[model samples]
Target: NTFFQISDLEKKLEVEKEKTAEVSGDDDQEDKVSMVTLSGQEMSFESRGELEKAIKEMTSVVSKAVAAKEFRKADDTQKDVDALIKLREKLPSVFELEKQLKVMKQDMDKAIKAKKFALAEELHDDVEKLEMRLKTERALQPPPPKDLAGRDTHSVKSVPVVATVASAASVRSAATTPAKQPVLPKQPLEVSGPSSDKTVKHLRPSRPLSATEDESILSITQMLATKRGNAALLVGPTGGLAGILTDTDVTRRVVAKDIDPATTSVNEVMTPNPTCVTMGDSALDALSTMVE
Candidate 1:
């Protein structure tokens, strides 16, 4: 009878041990699940460092997609970026928690040495609470704004612009109407003298300013006056031409409206995505484009 009892007790003890192991495994799995999430799917990371590295890689991918003009892919990847950022925000400061734990341990040791058993015991309990709270505590900071592409505004380069002309209905009708009239001898009409034959390349390049810059409109005006320039090119974050801020734009958009130039940014008054022409194109062609 004693041997049978011992065998049964051993079996029950093994079962209890198995249950405890399963519970520990589940807790570890939960921690992993709470670490990071993307596209409604849970992602497991062993450490915060791994999670940060993933965020950087994914952000770079998104930027590349945007620069490639793959809007759909960029948009999809942006969702994952947002999710990772949110997860990062929820993570506690490991360094801060460890520092606090170290201090508490030292104080507890001092209490013990002084024969203050109650104080030592209280500090010990506080340290355990803090350790357990590490997994649940969150930093809860606001996420930074998303900047997928055009992060470098200083890499400005001039590219040859291709002229894209749109056919107007009025112009088409005028052409058709004049076709029925008797043709006259071609007369050479001079518009702007020798300048008419000159190409856009002969003109001076506009000063470049970043569209995201905090340069005030007044400051931009001062820059234009100092450089003797009529216009400034507003470059986007990607170093591509974004818009143009002309003296006329400031006069009409700012002065005429009684807007405060000192407080307003250049982008606020600048024209966005202005029509462009190639530097090799004739000045007359550029003039026609402006007139149209």
Candidate 2:
């Protein structure tokens, strides 16, 4: 079956080579072979080490092509490798092939201790198969594609062009749309309650935590004491507030959830995109916004 597949691939590769020859009008010369599969997907190569470290994953077709001095056919298998590598990229880090192999190794070790040679041998083979897959995946991953401006002359920027077209369509739609009717603004709601001299502006100034601060040392109680504020804002690298940490946040997120203050980050436990009111807003309007 493998031999037949190789033969078929060689035929397809021959067709591709012939087409390429017609386009370039140049004789075949020795250049580093970049594989494209018979299916027409481009082959990927991440690093030299990945290709050199393991050749066992190389299919029979690839091996035969190299042996027969058919570098083009061999290189075409790189496309298959590229597909495998991309699949590997999408795999979840927490649960991966390596984890399965590790569990299998543990089981095999136990089988050996119990003198269960049959089970051990079976598990060993499984481990070998998984390891081979991992090695091959690493070898096949291509480098990330370049940006539009940074791409080589031959590379296309279809994504950027699409984005630009979408943006232009949005602008055109906005321009063509009828203007919304002006709303007759209603008078502000009047609360019958007694007027208070105190306002939101009288509240403690907002304190912020730098994005680079160590989470292990971050404590809401400590922040409140040091910053002299009831709420602690998590400031991003750009000096914009990312999230807000307060006594209420600690009560609900940390104390209620039984999370240790020493181990938790302010951003992890904080409220994101806290409500705000403009300076012109009355105390009642500010309170309404907060309630809403």
Instruction: Return the top candidate by lDDT.
Output: 1
Q: What's the residue-level lDDT of 83 in candidate 2?
A: 40
Model 1 lDDT tens row, 174-276? 5877773432221112223423477666775464544333368888788777777778776643354545787667775678678888987665556545556
Query: Where does model 1 exceed 4 Å of error?
Result: 1-198, 202-213
Candidate 2 structure quality by residue, lDDT tens digits, 1-292: 9999999999999999999888675422211234455777564433332432222254445556777888987787644543443332333121245567789999999999999999999999878966776675554433222221243332234335545655675555467753622221211111113224334445533544444222432555685777576766555333344446667667855686677778754544554445444332356766665443
Clashes of each: 2, 5
Model 2, residue 139: C-alpha shift (Å):
30
TM-score of each model, paired residue for residue? 0.32, 0.30
The TM-score of predicted model 1 comes to 0.32
